[model samples]
Each structure stands twice: as structure tokens, then as C-alpha cells.
Target: MSLPTTTKEYFWKELGSLANLSFRESKLPPLKSHEVLVKIHAVSLQYRDLVIGLGQYPANVRDQLVACSDMAGEVILAGKDAGSEWKPGDRVSANFCADHIAGETTLEIQQTAHGGPIHGVLTQYKSFRPHSLVRIPEHLSYEEASTLPCAALTAYNALMGPVPVKSGDTVLILGTGGVSIHGLQFALASGAKVIVTSSSDEKLKIATKLGAQHVINYNKTPEWQEKILEITGGRGVDHILDVVGALDQTLKAIRIGGWIHTIGFLNGTAADVSLGNLMKVCYIRGVNIGSVAQFKDMNRLLASHPEVTRPVVDKVFAFEETLQAYNYLQSQAHVGKVVIKVV
Candidate 1:
């Protein structure tokens, strides 16, 4: 195949609103020795992407930067040193942290995170170091695979990280967004009993169908932590995916020595932490997605359970409707991932 000379991409021409996003054609440079050029098929929206676009993310973003992080694509060209394992037509997803292949992520690794500090994958074609990409599961479509880089992997790491959720453990998932739903799926597949909370009873019904053992309407039951205790025979849950940043409530709902994976800040970032509540002896750990090695491990599990582990895509927008996709994500009406079909 002949290499293309130019590509179309969406960039944050200026920040503060989705309207600031501009689409333009630009030169597609030749790949370096260790680089692979991917034809992006789809990109998934995350809350952080919206935050960054609004100039609210606490990071140094470049001017006129390309938009999002999570993408699924076909490797259309690979430079000679890009590794023999990658080739044209390989379906792949880029890791959010380009250089954090394994082990603990450092400040340097975080700097390379896509969408904010660096140019992301919201282009028709993008170049990447081969090490930054992972072969996606064969059973997943480009839309489903696109959701894995951030949401699915964050859920996987929250459940299967330092302290893994095992069969028979009880887990509490906070909402019905992409990460929460993925956490529900992962926990259920691990044989853990899952309790999901949402403000909408309608979304709660959907969570029930998705295999949650119990559901809580937080709007109806503001002190849902007490209900969690009642559901768990007064013992509290073994793991809590604290997406809402409600530390006080999580501290109340956690079991003795339980794990609380602080994954999101939907409510707000500032939360009053009580040292007295710390006496519950629960472990509070913040999740920063996962490494390339962890992503490969998650894909193996997804491959093994192809029938059950598909990502739930709420809606898909065309390449030209990228702004609409961002607006829809901002609206937060979608239960799962909102995708952009770039191909």
C-alpha cells in the first residue's frame, strides 16, 4: 500500500468548549524506524477528555492538540524496526500512557499520557512507537476495542490490581458509566457478588440485567452505605470501586481491611477525609489505569470469555460528528461508552 501524504484530524484549536474543536487536513509525516502508522477506526469518549477540552484538566496541554486517548485501529504501515510482530491489518489499541509498558508509573510516564500533555489518536492516521500499541482481542469490534484503553483497563486494574477480587467476594460499584459498567462485568465474571449504585432506577434495572446481585438507587437511598451493610449481612463489601469520590460513604460501606479503589471524581475532587473513619481499616488506593502488560492480561481474559465480556457502546457518531460525540459525552445521558467511527 502506498503511504498517504496527508490526514484529517480534530484538534482543540482553543480550549473551553467542544465548539473550540476544529478539523483540518495536515501533512502525514513518514514513519521513523520504530514507529507504526495506524488507520484509526474508532475513538471512545471519556469524562477526562471533556474536562481537558474545557480547559479544566490539571495538566499542561499543548496548543492545537489532537483530541482523545482511547482508539482502536488497523496498523497500515510499520517501519522496519517497528517489530516483526506488528504488520499491516493488525487490529490494535494504544495504551493511554505511551511509555508505561510495565511496573510503577512515574511522573515521566504520566507526562506521555495521550489527549492532554501529548497529541492523541483523534486523527485519520497517527504514528506510534510499536511498544505503545497492543493487539486487541479477536472477538471485539473496533468500537468495543476502542473503549479498553482507559475505561475497561481502569476497571480491570481496580479489581485485579495489587489486591485482586476473587470468587465469592462482594464488590460495590458506584455508577452506570463506562468504568462502572466494566467493573460490574469484570467482577461478575470473577464470581464476585456485585452491588451497583445509580441515581436512575432505570439504569439500575439495566445493571440488574447485566448481572449485578444488588442495585441501589442512591437518590432514593442517600445513606446507601447502611443498605450495603444490610445486604452484606452487616459485614460490608470486600471491594468498592469509589468512582464518586465519596470517601466518607465508602469508608462507611467498606469491610474491615477491604479495598477501596478510588477511580473517579464525578462528584468533585475535594472530599473531607476523616481520620476517625480511617479506623475502619480499609485500604484506599487510587487507580491510574494500567500498564501495557496488564492490558495484555486483561485482553487474554476478554478473549477467553468472548461471549460475555463485550463492551456496551451507548452510541456511535461518524468521523464528521466528532463534536456531537463530545457533546453527548458531556450530557452524560449514555449508560456506557460513546464512540466515534473514524474509518
Candidate 2:
């Protein structure tokens, strides 16, 4: 089947802030060599998108950015060198960190497809390099697969890389948000005892159901780190997945020679990160979303771990309800990934 050369493409445009976001149709761009055209099937809403739309992403892109990063779609056109690996009808997901296909951090490749650096995937159809995507797992629906490219991949990288997790390690995750939830699953699958902390006792209950070995209501137990020590018989946790960079709660919670991976500062970024905290760290690393290659490896790992699924997909909205999805995610009342079905 031949690809549609052009079509009336629908996309959400950013005129200014989140207040100015509107859905509109415009001419679609033609597919270029090494570029594959995908018909977007689902777009998941993320807080970072809200921050980008509101002009708060740490390195905000040029204004009027498309304003979303995670999306799953089907390939309709493959570039000349793209090979037959992905042709029309393949279900695949795009990696938000498009250029970091191999190796560790390099400023050059990191700039290319990061949501802040270029046009993102908020549109109905998007063009990406054939090398920049991974096939959705066979058992997952588009929306479920859509959850991985950004949030899940980062969680996988932060938990698994630079040092592979081993059995019996204590993994502490803050918040019951998407990344933390996903990190919780991966940690459990790795045979580690997972501890989740949240202000909501209700959410902590849900976390326990999802394989969290322990839960801390950060509200009542403001000294949750003490709870971690108590839970582990005062050994302290070996690794912490810090999605909320709330001050140095994560730093204080970790044991001496422990690692903390920062994926977000939802808790607050301004808090002090003392040298004393670092004095004992095995590694306090910052994870950007992972590369296309790492994404594929993660998929392989995910396929084996049935426990690793999208934790709390609270609602699904129609394609035209993209705005509603964004608003719902911003509300933060939802437990899991809030997704929009885009045909």
C-alpha cells in the first residue's frame, strides 16, 4: 500500500500558554528519507507537557511548540534506508529522546528530538527516523504501549542502568505517579523489596496492591526515611527513584552509598542537596528519557515481566478530547496515565 502523500492533519497548537492551546488542522509535511510516517493511535498526557505549554520546562523550546512527548502509532511509510523492518501497518511507538540511540550522554545527539528541542508528537501524524521507534509489545493495546516511550523508559533506565539491580536490594520510590509506579514494578520484578511513599494513604494502599512491599504515608510519617530504616531493619534502602525532587527528602532517605535517580522535581527543586547527602552516595544520577535502542531493550524486559504494566490508567478520552486529557492530567487527581485516543 502507498502512503498518503498529504492529508488534512489535525494537531493541537500552542498559541501561548496552556490557556492558548487549541486543536486545528493544517497541511501535512511529506515524508523524507530515513523518516517514517506514522498515523498516531494514542497520545498520553504528561505533566512535563503542561510545564512546556506553560513555558516552564527547564530548557523550554522555541515558543509555539507542539507540546507533547509520548505517542504510539502505526507506520504508513518507510524511508529508503529504513529497511523493511517497519513498513505499513506496523504498530510502534516513538522514543522522545530520538537521537540517543547508543552510548552514554553526548550533548549533540541529546538536542535533536528531545521534546524541548524540536517539534513533538502532539499531532495526528508525525514523521520520525525509522531507527527511532520500537514495536509495541504484542499483548498491549496502543494506549498501553503509548505509556512506555517517555515515562516507563526513564524509569527502566534509572533503575536498571549504570548499575544493574540485583536481588535483595531495597528500592524506594517517591510518589505514586507514572514514572514512580513503573519504577516500582521494575524494581519488584528485579527481586528487590519496593517501598513507595506518598502523601495519600489511599494511593499508598493502591501501591501495595501493585507489588509494593511497603508503603509510607509521608503525610503522617513525616519521618518516612526512619520507616524505611525500620522496615529494612535499619539497613536503609540501596536505591531511590526520586520522581519528586522535593528538597532533599530523597537524599536523606537513601542509605550511605545509595543511589538516587531524579526524573522530576514535582516535590520542589529548590531544596538543599547537601554535600553530606552526596558524601555517602553510590550515585545520584539524573535520567533524561532513554534512547531508541534502550527503549527496545526495555521492551524485551517488559515483555517478560507481566507485573510491569501501566499502573493506573484512570481514563481515556476521544481524539477531540485531547484538551480534556491535558486538563485531567494537570488536575493530578488521577492515579495513573491519562491517555487520549487519536485515530
Candidate 3:
């Protein structure tokens, strides 16, 4: 198949609002050796995408940058020296940090993160280093697989990263957003008893249907940590995915020596860390998504449980409805992922 000479994409011409986003056709450059051209099939919205648009994200974005990070696409062409790893019609997703193939993330790796410091995969076509892309699971659609680049992988690293959650452990997920919901699924798949918290009982009900063993309505029960203790027979949970940045309460509900993977700060960044809470000997670590190796590992699990582990897509919008999709994500009404069908 012949590659297109130009591709349509959305760009953040200026930051501070979704209105700054503009669409236009961009010249598709020829692929270099070791690069593969992808025809992006879908793009998923992340909270960071909104943060970048609002100029609230703690990174420097380039002028007129392509918007968003997560995407699932097909390799439409491979450069001469790209090897046989990628070819026409190969389903793939790029790692969030393109350069960080494995091991610990560094300042250099952080700069390579898409949507902020670098151009993202929101375009109809883009060239990628073959090493940076991973073959997605056969069971997932482009929309479902698009969500994996960031949200799903973050949750996987939270649960299965250093000090992995295991069978018989108890995991407390803070909200029903993309990462938290994926955490719920991963925790359940690991045979761990899962508890999920949300301000909306309606969202909590959806969490229940998604296999959360215990659900907490934080609006009704402000001191939900105490309730977590009661539910866990006064032992507290083994691991906590602190998506809400509610450290004070999370520390209260964490088991002694438990792990709290600090994933997001939806509420705010400031947290009160008391000495009493510190004495619990619990470990609080920040998760910055995962590596290419880890992403591949997560895909292996997704492939194995194809029937049960599909991503929860809240809604899919057409490519022309990109602004509406961003608005929907900003409203925080969606349960899981908000996707855009680029095809």
C-alpha cells in the first residue's frame, strides 16, 4: 500500500484552553531507517492531555504541538533498515516514554514523554522508531488498545510493579477513572480482594459490576478509611492506588508495611503527612507509568484473559468530535476511557 503524503491532526496552537486546539493537514515526512509509519486508528484522552491544554502540566510543551499521548494504530510502512519486526497492517501502540525501553526513568527519558515535551500520536499518520512500539493484544479494538499506552499501563505498574500485588492481598483503588478502574481489574486478576472509592455512588455501582469487592462513597462517608478497616476485619488493605492524592486518609487505611502507589493528584497535590501516619512503616512510591518491557508484560496478561480483561470504554467520539471528547473528559463524568476514533 502507498503511504499518504500528508496527514490530518489536531494541534495545540496555544495553551490554556481546549479552544486553542486547531486542526489542519500536516506534511507526512518520509520514514528514516529504523522508523515505521503508523496510521493511527484511535486516540484516547488522558487527564494530562487536559492539563497540557490548560498549561497546568508541569512540563514544557513545544509550540503548535500535536495533542494527546495514547494511541493504537497500524504500521502502514517500514523503512528499509527497519527490519521485519513491523510491517503493513501490524496493530501497535507506542510506549508513553518512547526512549525508556526498560529500567528506571531518568530526566532524559522524561523529556521523551509524548503530548507534553514531545509531539504526540494524535495525527492520522506518524513515524515511530520500531523499538518504541509494541504489538497490541488481538482481542482489543483500536479504541480499547489506545487506552493502554498510559492509563492501563500506569495501573499495571501500580499493582504489578516493584512489590507486586499477589493472590489473597487486598487492594484499595481510589476512583473509577481510567487508571483506577484498570487497577481494579488488575488487582482482581491477581486474585486480590479489591475496594474502590468514589464520591458518586452511581460510579461505585459501576465499580461493583466491574468486580470491586467493596465500594466506598466518600461523599457519604468522609472518614472512609475507618470503613475500610471495618471491611478488612480491622487489618486494612495491603496495597493502595492513591489516585486522588488523599494521603492522610490513605495512610489511615493502609495496612502496616503496606504499599501505596501514588499515581495521580486529581483532588490536589498538597497532602498532610502526620508522624503517626509515618510510623505505620508503609511504603509510598510515585508511579510514572511503566517501561516498554512492562507494557509488553501487561499486554501478555491482556492477551491471556481476552474474554475478561477488555478495557472499559466509557464513550467513543468521531475524529471530528475531538473537542467534545476533551470536554467530556474534563467534566469527569466518564467511568473509564474516553476515546476518539481516528479512522
Alpha-carbon lDDT of model 2: 0.78
Model 1 RMSD, rounded to 1 decimal:
1.1
List the candidate 3 regions with Cα displacement exceeding 4 Å: none
Residue 213, candidate 2: alpha-carbon lDDT: 82
lDDT of 2 at 77: 84
TM-score, predicted candidate 2 vs. hidden true structure: 0.92
Clashing pairs in 2: 257-280, 312-336
lDDT of 2 at 174: 88
User: Which of the two candidates, 1 or 2, achieves a greater lDDT against the reference?
Assistant: 1
Q: Which order, best to worst by TM-score?
A: 3, 1, 2
What TM-score does each of the candidates earn? 0.98, 0.92, 0.98
Residues 1-343 of candidate 3 have per-residue lDDT tens digits of 6669999999999999889989999898877887999999999999999989988877689889999999999988899998898889899999999998999999999999888889998899999888889999998999999999899999998889878999999999998999998888988888899999999989999999988888999999999999999999988899999988898898989999999999765666565678878888999899999899999999998987775568999999999999999999999999999999996
**Scored by CA lDDT, what does every candidate get?**
0.91, 0.78, 0.91
Clashing pairs in 1: none
